[model samples]
Target chain A: MGNFMEWLDRRFPATQVWNDHMAKYWTPKNFNFWYYFGVLSIVILVLQIVTGIFLTMHYKPDVTLAFASVEYIMRDVPWGWLIRYLHAIGASAFFVVIYLHMFRGLIYGSSREPRELVWLIGCVIYVALMAESFMGYLLPWGNMSYWGAQVIISLFDVIPYVGPALSEWIRGDFVVSDATLNRFFAFHVIAVPLILCVLVFLHIVALHKVGSLNPDGIEIKENKDKGGIPLDGIAFHPYYTVKDTVGVVVFFIIYLGVVFYWPEGGGVLLEKDNFTPANSLQTPPDIVPLWYFTPFYSILRASTADFLVVLGSLTAIAAIATPFIKTKRSNKIAAFVGYGVIAICLFIFDAKWWGVVMMAMAIVVMFLLPWLDKSPVKSIRYRSLPFKIAVTIFVLAFISLGYLGMHPVSALSTIQAQTCTVLYFAFFALMPFYTTWGKTKPVPERLT
Target chain B: MSSNEESSNGDSTNENRSRRRFITGLTSAAWAVSAAYAAVPLVLSMTPSARARNAGAPVEFDFSKLQAGQMVKVEWRGMPVVVLRRTPAMMAGLDEVTELLADPDSADSVQPGYAQNPARADANKNEILVMLSVCTHLGCSPVEKLAVGPDPEMGEDSKGGFFCPCHGSKFDLAGRVYKNVPANKNMVIPPYQYLDENVILIGDDEARNA
Candidate 1:
């Protein structure tokens, strides 16, 4: 075995790669419960792909046969229910793990400075994962899946001139039909998964390039011993690998519990409307998307004519205050231009199109987090009181929007969502100011 | 730091360098042309096929059996086109609710030139409304609440038309969109024409215009 390993090492960097990534890789010893999500994300991705492969074996992509085929998988295919449940439950678990993972990064300032590329790649992975989940959701050919695809695809129709044609091209027809289903199946099962794997690989490579940030936000490399190993760091292989195994065991207990007892997650993981076959003629009384997407959906639904005016007024105030703020001359000019453009769009375009824009911007904003945050310190442990308050309000607004999206829209709910939408954008827009406003606690030298 | 370093040996002349660069540019242009050629079929493959397009050909429906204050749905281009025979009360309500509509004149909405009025119905058959059932906001079909009084789904002062279940957008009796809803424009009226007193053709208006 030793001789074989030596021969392989000469041909390829077999042992070298292992040592570089695992055995000799130095990670901070003070990792908390938040760190488990990274490993759990990988585990869920694997579970989804494996279960998806099994589902495709029995699944039909044709619109006519697709709905019945899923029922067949549940009733006839041996242990197919387990595979289906695992895939369905795993989809929600993936989002739960990903959201927590992103939240952990935000709190620890993992996107700061050198780690920006890591965070950017991770954001791309998140977008790709959303596409994957959306396409997968349509594979069941259920009532909710049909209308969900209809509503989402129709959003493209709000674009200026090319909107109608763009949507037609996307749907491969005038409306959601067999062509749409077949193409979505192809993308869901093949194209997106391949992209996701590549993006995840890039995310990890970028992460390892800038080493992992600890809860204390201290760089372990800054204080290496004479032999070139950090005192507060440990080998990732024997230490983190064992620790991640424990996380996996605990994750499975909760994940499989949902699969066995509460796969529907009370009409969240798998919606109750999805049990019936798709009918285009009649829409369900209250059509809601999956839980993970509700926050953005609420943003889309909140953009009325009055909401546009509100947005314009806020932009006008910011533009008026731009000269007084201590920013670069170029930044002031850019802010003026951006505000002017937004004001013009508010006048020219319809509110529905702006809703689509707001929904997309909500996700696209996260990609700019590295630059948005101008805090002197990294972790929440060292962050200002104002920074913590902003984060708290942002999180509450996000949760409120998600809750609103899952229920039927009302006059009161629409007003509430519009208010939350303002708060959501304000958190990102005012981040630099609040982060630099209050006093930060002194960061310790070592990870404690 | 630059491509000049590779040619530091001074073995290559300027003419030789220019010729090499020209070839490289030509090769890149050729590859771009080939890629564009390859991509045409890929993009075309995703658009509506001949079969799907054929399915969208004009639909003819006889609405004689459709009673007043009742609506019938017919499929045109895989979309629900609702044809409603409005009662006299509904027509009177359409005029009264002009203030409540976003586009009462249908100036910014899609319809044939003849049907671009408050009723959103053909000129000869002004009491009969023909509009695409799909909501202007998202594609979900709105449920009809054709009454003129108070009710749920339609607000307390109903003046009822259609109610979009997905986003709560309301429409008047003529499918004129209510103000401040997610839908900005009125519901679309398909390119339709009356073939007879009781029969109509949807999805084509060429003969009527000519």
Candidate 2:
């Protein structure tokens, strides 16, 4: 056995790579429930890809046949219903895990300084996953799928000059037809999945390079022993592997419950309109996107023509001026200028274009997270009361926006959505000021 | 340090700066060339092929066998186009229901230049009403309620039109959506031309208009 081990080590760096990433890799000892989501995300990703491959075997991409083929998979193929449900439910689960994982990062300041590349790579994975889910949603060829594609594709029409032509080019015709469906299937199955896998690999590689942040947000590596082993760290293989197994078991319990009993998630995960075949002439009355996208959708819906211009100019000025505004006096002046620009834009442009800009900025703001945060401490635990309150408000605002996105648009809901949108942007934009305002707790030398 | 050594150090620093600049320029040029080369296939792939463009070709229908007050559905580019032969009563109903429509003048909606009137029908063929069956509110196909009396869904005093089962949006006999319904705009009128008195070509309006 020793001779074989030596031979294999010469052939491949199997043990060395294992020790670097898993066996001897040091993880913080203070990791809690929030840490499970990172692993859970990987599990869900694997589930989606495996079941997606299985679904491709029985699925047809043609416009006339796609709907029936999905139905056939549900009814005819042996345990095919389970596979389809797993894939469908897995899509929702992926977002659930990813959102929680991101929230964990927010609270722990995992996106700070040394780990900025990891966060950026994770964001890339997020964008790619969204594209993957979107293209996959079209494969069912349901009413919601067809119209959702139509509405989203039409959003490009808001662009000047090349808008209409660009949309036509995207659809491969004047509208969502067989060509659009075929191309989307190719992308969903082959192109996007490949990109997603590559991004996921990069995300993990970047994370390992930076090591994991703990709940205390203290650098464990700074307190290394003579042998260079971190004082507050344990081997990742034995400690975290066993701990993650428990998380996996608990996750599967809830996941299987939804997969078997409530795969539709009460019309949030899978909409009722999606049961019917795609009809180009007939559009379902309420064209709300899937649940994961509702927050941004609500923001998009809130932008009326005049309001759009105001918000657009404000967001543009703030995003552009933030990096350059160095001194406190300049920041104050910039804030005043931002307000003046908003007031000016109210009379300049219409709300329709601004709403589009607002929707885009919601995602774009996340890329600036590492810089926007100005807290002395990395974790929320050590932050002052106001910072904690701000985080709570931001989470609530996000939840409210998501809830508003799922319902029919109305005056009351629209007002709520607009408020939430403002709150959401304010959380990021005001982070530098608010995060530095409060008194911070001193971090301990070691994990308690 | 000796003056000779200092001068050589300055020369080496200059050489390093120029060398670094050269490498940066070369790398940027390589990236630009690669990006331009790669964009060719990607841009070309995005263009609509001849087959896709041809998918919207005009579909012809012979309405000679259709009876008055009857509607038949034809498939055009994977969309359902309804051609209805309106009765005299239905024709009169179109003008009567003008007050209850969201777009009575067809001002806010799209149709060919010749069909941009209250009736939303081709100027030459008023009796034969052709429109895309999609509802403007959300896109469900509204079912025809062509009777002159009350509809269970649209309430009493309801004139003949179409009713969307999904959202209860009502449309008049001329495909104009009712006021205050989920749908806010009238049904779309496809670009169409009369091939002859008895034949119509859906999706082709250029020949007669030109």
- Per-candidate Cα lDDT values, in order, are 0.92, 0.84
**Deviation in Å, model 2, residue A274 alpha carbon:** 2.0
Q: What ranges in model 2 sit over 4 Å off? A: A306-349, B1-35, B60-75, B79-111, B116-189, B195-200
Residue by residue across B1-210, what tens digits does model 1's lDDT show?
466776664437888778889999999999999999999999899999999988878999999999999998898887888999999888888988899889999998888888888888877889989899999999998989988888777788888799998888999988899999989788898888778778899988887868
Residue A336 in candidate 2 has what lDDT?
Answer: 70
Best candidate (score: DockQ)? 1
**Tens digits of lDDT, candidate 1, A372-448:** 99998999999989999999999999999999999988889999999999999999999889989889999999889
What fraction of the reference interface contacts is present in each model, in order? 0.79, 0.24
For model 1 chain B, the run of ten residues with the poorest summed lDDT: B2-11
lDDT of 2 by residue, A154-184 (tens): 6676677897798888888877888899999
The CAPRI-style docking tier of model 1 reads medium
